[model samples]
Target: MIKKFLLTMCLLAALAVGGFLYVKQSVTDFIAQPLKIEQPHLVTVERGNNLNTIISKFVDDQWINPTQFSTLVRRFHPNLTQIKVGTFEVLPGMTFEQALNTIINGKEYQLAITFIEGSTFKEWREQFKQAEYLEHETDGLTEAEIARQLGIEHDKLEGLFLAETYHYSVGDSDLDILKRAHRKLDVILEQSWASRQDKLPLKNSYEALILASIIEKETSVPSERERVAAVFVNRLNKRMRLQTDPTVIYGMGDRYDGNIRKKDLREATPYNTYVIDGLPPTPIAMPGKASILAAMNPENSNYLYFVASGTGGHVFSKNLRDHNRAVQQYLRQLRSKK
Candidate 1:
């Protein structure tokens, strides 16, 4: 009787092991099967989302059997408790294992934002605020507070970020993009300063940044950038006011009615180059690398004035009489347009 009982116990143990092996193979096969979706599907992994939630979504969509999928995940990625936050694209024919791997690695979507040259810091912030993919950590913070958080010591925050397209993942913060732009600006500034032409009227790299911002706002034409910088450099050398109209518009702030008149130039704001002796207290707009390079190495010319030449470019002049002629030509062109 004892021998019979022992033999029966061995048989039961063998059957249990066989059943476990069969279940394991079935789960593996389930994971290896093609997904149910006919087209590509977007899977958004929100921050702190549990693995079960992700699985449940797929299960609800009839993409996979929950029990089999859970068994497969346990057998394979047993330690994976959370998915990375981002927009992930799951292809129609991908196996469950491939989809899981894609989610875990966070390699789904690439997002980009551009900060345009000659745009103000305010505009850059507005763009950041409007971006849906980026996490807005700087939202509702004052300019000073935001600058402080980024460790930027500039009294005025305008033009601190570089003008370029920054790429990031979905879970990235606005501060991350800001830091990237700031670092890029810092790198470019140092290089420009190190290679700058000698005896420039500007005091330091910060002043170069200020001049670069002015140059960026002066003209959009690539050929005119150095000429514009040269005009400003000449004015600085001759102790003439760097009377650029963009400076007055910036100084006017909320009061500028899309026009500059005698009073705006006459107002003694720190940014009003018509009233101030030298560069503004801060950069007026974000400058690109070309503008910064142009500021550092202005063309050797006698040009001290520039006016819009009816076209998108400028008419540069060396003296008041020529500048006046250019201004008259600009008026004639405007009259013709009307």
Candidate 2:
């Protein structure tokens, strides 16, 4: 009688162990099952979302038991309960476990905005106006008002922001992007000024920024940055008017209709370098790092003038006679093309 009772208890114990093993294997297989996404899909987890909310989506889509998924999450993957708040891209054929890992790891999708070198702050604002998913907090605000908010001392906000690609998440404001760019510009300008070449004729970093903006507008060719810098530097050293056309155009504001006449150059404005004795009152545009560095450390040259070459570059000249020849050559190229 005792031997029969012991055998009966042992058989029941064996059946219970087998049933537990079977349930564990079934849950593991369910977690490893591939998602039904035919293509890539974006999943956004907003604030106040938890494991239940996330799993509810999968449960609705896959016809899976929500209780089962929730029990597994609580038992094995408790980290999924605290997922990140951002947009996530889930690819096809990814398992539920893998997708949960992606959300928990928090590598959110990022969008980018690019500012062209030598582009004006107004152009940057226009880009922000057109960018998708970015909050336009700076929209309809004047430059002076925006400058005050940015803590800039003056209303002259040109060249204060750096030109580069800035990444942001959804719900980020345009002002947020500008803040980051401004901080980066400050660090770069401080570093460049600390290691600048001697006798650059720039009294301060702001002056360097102004000169850099001029250099940026002067040439699109990378090699010609130093050349353009030298021309402006030599003019500054000689106490001569910079006589740059872009400065004139900037001073003209919306009155500038593409063509710059002699009358425009002679017009007296704070930004008109032709009419001003030294650098402009403010930078003309947002200059890149190369132009900023060139302004701080110009090459040793006596180049006082430059004219656009026919082949998308500039011809530098030290004397007025040579500069006139290059100008004539540029006009001839334009006429020949016509």
Q: Write the per-residue lDDT of candidate 1 for residues 102-140, one digit (tens) a residue.
A: 888757677789878999988988999888678999889
Clashes of 2: 0
Give the per-residue lDDT of model 2 (tens digit) for 1-338.
99999999999899998987766776677667788778877778899987777788878877344444356655665655668888887889788778878888858978899999999988998899999779999988999999888888879789999999999988899989988999999999999999999877889999999999999998988898988999999999999999999999889989999999988888889998888899998899999999999999898999999999999998899999999999999999999999
The global C-alpha lDDT for each of the candidates, from Candidate 1 onward, is 0.87, 0.88
Displacement of residue 204 (Cα, Å) in model 2 is: 1.8
RMSD of 2: 3.3
Compared with the true structure, the alpha-carbon lDDT of candidate 2 equals 0.88
CA lDDT, candidate 1, residue 20: 77
Please provide TM-scores, in order, for all candidate models, with all chains considered together: 0.81, 0.84
